[model samples]
Target: MEWLLTPGPVQLHPKALEALSRPQLHHRTEPARALFLEARSLLKRAFGTEGEVLVLTGSGTLAMEALAQNLFAPGERVLVPVYGKFSERFYEIALAAGLRAERLDLPYGRVPRPEDVAQRGFQGLLLVHSETSTGALVDLPALARAFKEANPEGLVGADMVTSLLVREVALEAYGVDAAVSGSQKGLMCPPGLGFVALSPRALERLKPRGYYLDLARELKAQREGESAWTPAINLVGAVKAVLEAVMPHLEAHLALKAWQNALLYQVGEALGLRPVPEVKSPAVAAFYLPEGVPYGAVKEAFARRNAVIAGGQGPLKGRIFRLSLMGAYDRYEALGVAALFREALADILPAS
Candidate 1:
């Protein structure tokens, strides 16, 4: 009866849950291989990529680490644009991996202009397609084109963690060298498995890959319908179910998101609550709280209503809150949550 509106570890479909309930199979057995192949094929279809989709047994951060380890050598310069919490995580990963990293820091919700990044001499660029923390979306095509034109040899990696299956991003057409996403967001599954898709340019640049975080090795194994390490069998099975359910309803999904976004605007206007960027995410919508209302109180109030919403991350912790519109929920459920949120605000904020 709990409604999840958080970005990651989103609401799972009943069918996906049922898929996970299936009895476990040997990871090396034929049944497991068949499941793996089915999940991999569905992933490629979801991403619209002919390139290999490597499934990692960890969260999306694992894929980010794989990208850093596989694509660049130590001391190679990488440009990362910091617009939100997740984007900053990419920078942290790059630095920890010992890669020389340059950051283009934009205030949360503001997109860094392409010209701002062109001056940096970087061998790779890390971008977050949608900044879930502040609900800001970067111009994916413009960012990709900017890096490609600046350094054709450079790899363009993206954290499509929040926007992958929910929104349409033409990875091949946009020239994105590599991208990563978790199973939870848009995939309608639980968070355990991660997906990474690499372009030809990225594949060509891969060097001696580390054992666990090696994209090339994973891709090689995945192409042969295997995994380099023990795969998440249950999560993979759940992903297959989620993909099967979503494939038929892709159009309905988009339409629902469109409707939800409009309703969010309407509700926010009624409550005098302003969106952080004045822009919305088809995946998640973040709003600024009215003065004198505590974010924690509002969250608790929503919990009482049997709904959960996410609060802002990092510097925006108290001032902003986020509502995820992605995953299995429909407009009716979201509107119910929105109604509770409006009521919570009314209880806390003074009348105009």
Candidate 2:
């Protein structure tokens, strides 16, 4: 009955878990190839794109690195809209790639506006669709359109690690040249599978810097029912199960998220806690701590109950806490989390 309601590496679906425990299948086998390709098609639907989807053996960050390596040419200038920890990672990634990366640092929980970088003459725009640290979901379509309008020659890239399946987004419609996601989040599978869906334009032309993450090579291999290297067969199996058994119910899943979001907000308000002031996320809810409450103490309290939620990160640390209702979670699990959170809050911030 213990719940793990943190953002990434969420609770796995029963079927995915069961599938993960099965014996490995050779990566190049027909059955394995079919599973991998099937997962890709499911992922295309998840991303709402007819574009090419490539899966790699790494975390979501790996896909981000792949995008930076492949897309950012040396001496290129890129715009990153920063609001939380993950967004900061993109800025850092661009800098590490030796690109002239500039960012519009906005307040936490605030979505970046289209006008924020209207005149920025950058060659690319990097964005995180959901700021997990602050539990904020940005207007990705608007930002993508804005970037496209401002710099038609430039490309739009998105990190959908937290939003891929749990949140609604159409990569093609949003003009996202590349979008990255991980199995640990919305896909409700084991960690290690990183996915990137690329528009045809991006696929036709990208100078990948890294040998391991060459989308050209990976895509070719995948198309031929192969891998560039030994694949993570177990994790791929888990993802295949997720794609087969879970993703088909996307509408119901989204409805469940909406319901959970409203219920959590109602529960938090009843306990005198409030979400960060902005357009909150349906996947993760970041709540401002009550006055006189100690963050570490409350986190430890949850741990003592054999459950683990997340404390905020970076600038929001110790002030806001996050709860993720991703993966195979439902109202029954929500009720458990709510009860534990209530008890912990009462213990930490008793009537005053």
Candidate 3:
């Protein structure tokens, strides 16, 4: 495939792919335990947190749900700023977990300001640092600082699935209590594993609401180099491989953001496509599809070239389309993809 540019399950790095296909190991064994421990340590660096990073055997949503259920008690007022689909998912998870979710709903492409959120005042704040559906990246450090100033005891949780490796998420420096991420997007691995990086305060607040997704139980076991249940052994191996490659030379990994933004902006400008969100995310870019251009035509055009791009989700679906610059894409590959993006656009747009 020339591209696997949908929001998640992106093309994995060769090392991660090799690790994913390696012979399965028993989770109780010594080697498996060592792998778990190594991956957890690397993940802490990825999240930029001195606290615990819990590896879960599910998708990113599972981590988000875990944070919702664990970080706050029932009936605690949690402020959720809903701007796009993923942010809305955070709010939904909070409500489902029996928290008093106070939503500050904004239009799909609008980025929520920190002051506005702090003004609302709640016991906890659940936010999507990068909203993939609309390609909006929030100012997380500012938001976290503001929230901490207003409600010092309040916990702040972030969905960093799209922002994890693409952007520098300094959880400790930013004062984020908890953050959730997945393997597929910035980790350059296949889907399966979810991670929750928690501050010491967040760890203390953890009250397990369920058995399978219980953070408290997982934390106890993980600290001892084990999993609470049968783990995704292959996926864990893949994560360790990717992190080993990334953590040593971290600056290059973080540079993916700037490279992606440049590619997306150049493509959008050359093709006359308007970006959906005012503040774009380097992880993904969404644009309003040209008038009279159905998403089907766009998909088919890209498919012809063995390239894949994503369409918008929720209310923006059919009206907009998305492109991703995640995975282990370097400058040369980005240039090639940008060229292919132009060709794909040429194939779809009517003859001028």
lDDT digits (tens) for residues 1-352 of candidate 2:
6678788788888878898778878987899888888878888888888778888998888899889878878789999988999999999988988889998899977888888867558889999998888888888888888887889888889999988877687877888888999989988887898988888778866877668888778888987667797888788888878877766688888888767766777777888897983887788878898876768887887788887888888889899887778868877877777787777777777775
Quote model 1's TM-score.
0.95
Q: TM-scores, in order shown?
A: 0.95, 0.96, 0.97
lDDT of each: 0.81, 0.83, 0.87
TM-score of 3: 0.97
Comparing 1 with 2 on lDDT, the higher-scoring candidate is 2
User: Per-residue CA lDDT of candidate 3, range 292-352, in tens?
Assistant: 9999898888888888888978899899988887877777777888887888899877667
Better of 1 and 2 by TM-score: 2
Q: Give RMSD to native, each candidate.
A: 1.6, 1.5, 1.3
In Å, residue 303's CA in model 3 sits off its true spot by 0.8
lDDT tens digits, residue span 1-352, model 1 = 8878787778888878999888887888888888889888888777766676789999999988888878889999999989889889999999988899998888887776777667547899999888888888788778778777888778888888888777776567777878899988888888898888876666777864688887767877887678999888888989988888887777777778767766776787678888886345677878887777789987887788787888989989999888886868877887886787678677677767
* lDDT against true structure, model 2: 0.83
Clash pairs, model 2 backbone: none
Clashes of 1: 0
